[model samples]
Target: MEETSKLQAEAKPMIYPSNGKAKEALINEKQPEVRPVRGSALRQVLVAFVANIGTINTGMVFGFSAVAIPQMQMPNSTLPIDEDQASWIASLSSISTPIGCLLSGWMMDALGRRVALLLVEVPLLVGWLLIATAHNLPLLYAGRLFVGFGSGLVGAPARVYTAEATQPHLRGMLSALASLGVSFGVLLMYALGAALPSWRHGAGVSAAVPLVALVLAAVAAPETPSWLIAHGRPKEARCSLARLRGDVCDIDGELDQLTRGTSISAGDGKSRSDMAASKRQTEKPEPLIKTLFKKSSLWPLGILVAYFVIYQFSGVNAVTFYAVEVIRAAGIGGGDSDYLTAVAMGVVRLAATAAACILMRRMGRRPLTLISSIGCGVTMLGLAGSLAYLEPGDFSILSWLPIVCIFGFTITSTLGYLVVPWVMIGEVYPARVRGTLGGLTTCAAHLSVFAVVKTFPYLQHLLTRPGAFCFYGCVSLLGSIFFATLLPETKGRTLQEIEDYFTGVTPTLGPPKENKKKIKSKELNGSVPV
Candidate 1:
């Protein structure tokens, strides 16, 4: 036991990159560490954000169901579908997302981030075209399947790209852009669906989004330097870093950190022959089942799994997939009122996500999530009460109340729970297994999403709408408490700092002093203060 303890205490951090020669050159101590300018680093983030348009295409695809379903069921429409088909349409994206995640992991590792993302656009573009031209149900289903595959695949590379490409300080805010892009995509369709004469009439428009993404990804985006280094292309890695560094030709400290895992102090000059004998000896990664149990890996995987459970059960999918049904059930008839309300909610979610840029920076992640979870619980309970107590006739007079509560929930969820988990997913893991772990967690989360979306009608049938909401409310309330007790603050810190927190190492960068004091004081008060 003492020997085990001593061994643990004496352990050294592993090197991250696979380039044998670069590893030796990377540790050269004669070089001075260049502190990358915050202003310059912020600009590098723009490339990742532009490529994130692919993520927006995902939201557009899901939003298509919201608008297309009713049109597909129209009496005079060319391809009206039954309730079963509509349900299948809504749930298929979730079904294929997991499969896409698994395959995307391999593609990301094999093809590189930029090329893998470009590959993602191929199916999404073709799928939209198939959707645009389809006259029969099979073609429509096949198109949806392809789009689902792309959506599922996009998450890992998008995450890996943003996480690897951005400076550690800008990581959280930039990562939030993925979800923000998703909201924008959803909002575009929400507005477009309401404006277009018919869903089928959206020709030459819907496919434009992914095509733009494809073009931008190919022309504007840079390959991640870390991926380049891992593949033994240090010259390309150096070039990628120089580009990301903005007007700088020399690779900075961040590049060394990437290649070596931990930051290394400069070593004295060594003979070129000494460096020549170096060879990379990275161990083969374990299988996914065994990978799940590592101390560093387990926290992120377990928490994300729980987060998805709480997230999906928050009724986001149900609310989005059946916004019209929800309003109609609340005694408002399906028509202009329902679509307008959904657009309003979509706007709310988008606006809140935009605001999250500031909130996450100001309040930090744990606080935002706690606030979001608790507020979601409260709003959901209010929705349940509104449904249970309000008379059908009285809905005309007080019809706006439920919308207000939903807006409130949107404010809360988007501020924290909706986007932060994803940000952490990008931030929390070691780069060695990041792709594999990313795929697995995303797949699991989407599977939960599928289960929740498919069961919405059944859940409503079993508990009634009000009862279903009450269940979500109670679950959210519990989720808030769980976060309060356990979720670590991740905002404003580097990925290394967050990993250190999970691994029980002293965090290299702690929160600002005022923020730390505020967090502790809030915890002492028995609430996770936001």
Candidate 2:
């Protein structure tokens, strides 16, 4: 093990700057730039573009029910399903998400982020094709499962890759960009669903976008340099870093940091032995799972779970999936009403997400989350009140109220739940278990989604639509309080700084200074150890 570690370290490129000094010398020579280079910015944009395609695809699945519901309710239609059975089509996607999450998490750790991402396209393409071609319930269910699997597989790796690649200072903004992509995708799907003549056509069109995204990702996306360094391939790491950083930017200092973090020293053990030990340890990895149960990790996890429950139960999914039905139940007329409401909700969600990106850095994570939660709770209460008092036949009052409430819900969701939870999950965990933990949390959240989507129709049937929404409002209230108390403020902090904050350690915010006398003494002693 020791010999292998030494050899791996020795194989690393030992590049000295033209100024004839170590790279750290250059870092200490000036303050680090606040802004990233053009290449890094471009990479951020690309990551956002790819990552949000999954969200858009998920939205497409949700919107499918809107189209399917009408078909199921039609007088002469031969579809063998009621509203409850039809809801299963959407719920099936959520159920499949957790399975994909578990698989992708392990695969990402074993393979690499790029490989995990590329694999997702397989399920995604197949799912879309199935949905596009299906004439029966069984094929439709199979297609939705595939789409869910592909989206889940892509989620964690995309976030981890984007977070690892960008400078820490720009992390929030870049993360927000990914969220914006989700909003953009949702909006696009909503618009397409509204404009298209048939559900299958809409599904096909949505499927085509991800196919394009898959090709672009395969062709242009660079493998994360951090992953290469972790696997003891420093030369390859350097090349990947160069490709990501571009020609003019110097990556030697960043490379050193990556090496220092991942290096297995002679005193540590052999690389192969460490790998074996790691494999064995992970084979029965209790500590990794237990970390989420620790006091330090628990609050963050609770906050995430609470946020997701609120986000799902706050009736956003209900509206997104059944907007037209709800609007019709309120006595609004027109076959296009559902699609129109969906498009409007998507627009509001996009706007709200944009507002969140602008405000998140300034207000900090906790404050914005608190505000959004409280706002959503209030809006939900209003929705519940309007639903309860207004009779079904009162078209004048009932028609616009549901639409307004749905819009309110979308805006609040954008501000608080939709994007912030994802950003927090990416930020809060320790580097060693970040990917695994994030995937686990996402699985838990989606399980909640599975419950809500599957049971919502039944719940509405059992206790009118007003009762279902009222229950959601109460959940939103509890979630608001939980988030206000538990989540920490994470606005301008670096990744290392955020890690230190969670673990109760002080981070070194800047490079240490060299004392002139100490340096002279070291020079006289003929060497200095860093």
Candidate 3:
């Protein structure tokens, strides 16, 4: 402890970056040593905010079909879409999203996370513009495809950026903010869908969000320190770290730890630089396929892929893409009230996601997900039961059951299943192949979404609404078992620590290990604190 204090007392203020370049400063030995201060949580939040702004546009893309499909199906509509075309319009984005995820994975590795985010504006703007002016089926299909591709591109980078940039204490909340942005965007679209005269106007207005995201990414956000260090730009990493941490804290220790990588321990024979040099000299670069097949990659990949399958088939995309139809099937409201209820659901989701940001830090991941999954199962089963057994005139008295169930499911799912997986996608993977694995997981996710959303209409026809609800409910309960048995708690752990767990090495240079018992407890039985 005394030696730790001495080290802390000897620390110096970090040099902040300016105009994308870090200004270097020499330390004066005669000057008094400065102790490290806590990092600025405010700057962390700002960077998180900027990184995730594009998610709002993502929300708009998903919700657009909800409004547009109903509008296009109306009598005397110009671009009349039958059920098949409408399903294509909604599901095409999922098909194209995997392409975007692959591109994002490669770009995040090659160009950097910030650059990947900035480049996404091109697809988003073009897609929204196409949707705004589209006059025919093919044009509309093309527009939705473009928007889905852009939406896919935005997700991984934003989550990865927040995870890498912020301190661990703030990581969960900041990372969860990405989902908050998506919820707000969905709400914004729902409002626009109700208030605007046409879906075209809504699509036109939605383009403005990506433009703002571009400006924020270009002007306000810095490249993540992890990316800079991985690319051998240690100086730039230090600068970016300094800026994110603000002038109050000494970043030298953190910077050195980052440079050393996660493998360093007390008895390590060689430094990280020596290891890198030896590997470069002795071996060929490992093929991407080999990397993908590694235990570290496959373990997390399997969990995420299965979780995403649960998330999509649990009726999330079905609710999101076809909210009006689902609500109508619930038989509570008529006409404009259904849109009003959709907006209300959006508001609930946004608020619940905000609560999740707080709860994530307080309640941890495992418990909230368990609670959420169980709640989803209960609510969905309740909805199905009510739909199945209730007499037609009985709706007059128990009229609130369907809508209540819908809202309950929305709240429950948003709290954990919808939001936490996105956070895990950013946190659980090893940094060496984070971009590739993240994209694959995201690709898997969207593919599941495509399958679920595209087949939902058919499922409703074949199984009927009650049967469909029963299917989703059963899936949610079964998924809770996965959460219980397989999922690891990531709350309060640094991204590096989480990665270390998957790699099966004790993290010697990461966050404090006082919480080892907590992590162990979480893993053993998936228990949460009271």
Would you give me the overall lDDT of model 2? Answer: 0.68
Off by over 4 Å in 2: 1-40, 76-80, 261-299, 330-333, 392-400, 507-530
Residues 465-519 of candidate 3 have per-residue lDDT tens digits of 8999899999999999899999888876666556666765543323334545544
Among the numbered candidates, top lDDT falls to 3
The per-model lDDT (C-alpha) reads 0.74, 0.68, 0.83
Error of 3 at 487 (Å): 0.3
Sort order, lDDT high to low: 3, 1, 2
Task: Highest TM-score: give the candidate number.
Answer: 3
- Each prediction's RMSD to truth: 12.5, 10.2, 9.6
- lDDT, residue 8, model 3: 67
Report model 3's TM-score to 2 decimal places: 0.86
TM per candidate: 0.83, 0.79, 0.86
Clashing pairs in 3: none
Between candidates 1 and 3, which one is better according to TM-score? 3
Which parts of model 1 have CA positions greater than 4 angstroms off? 1-39, 263-293, 332-334, 395-399, 507-530
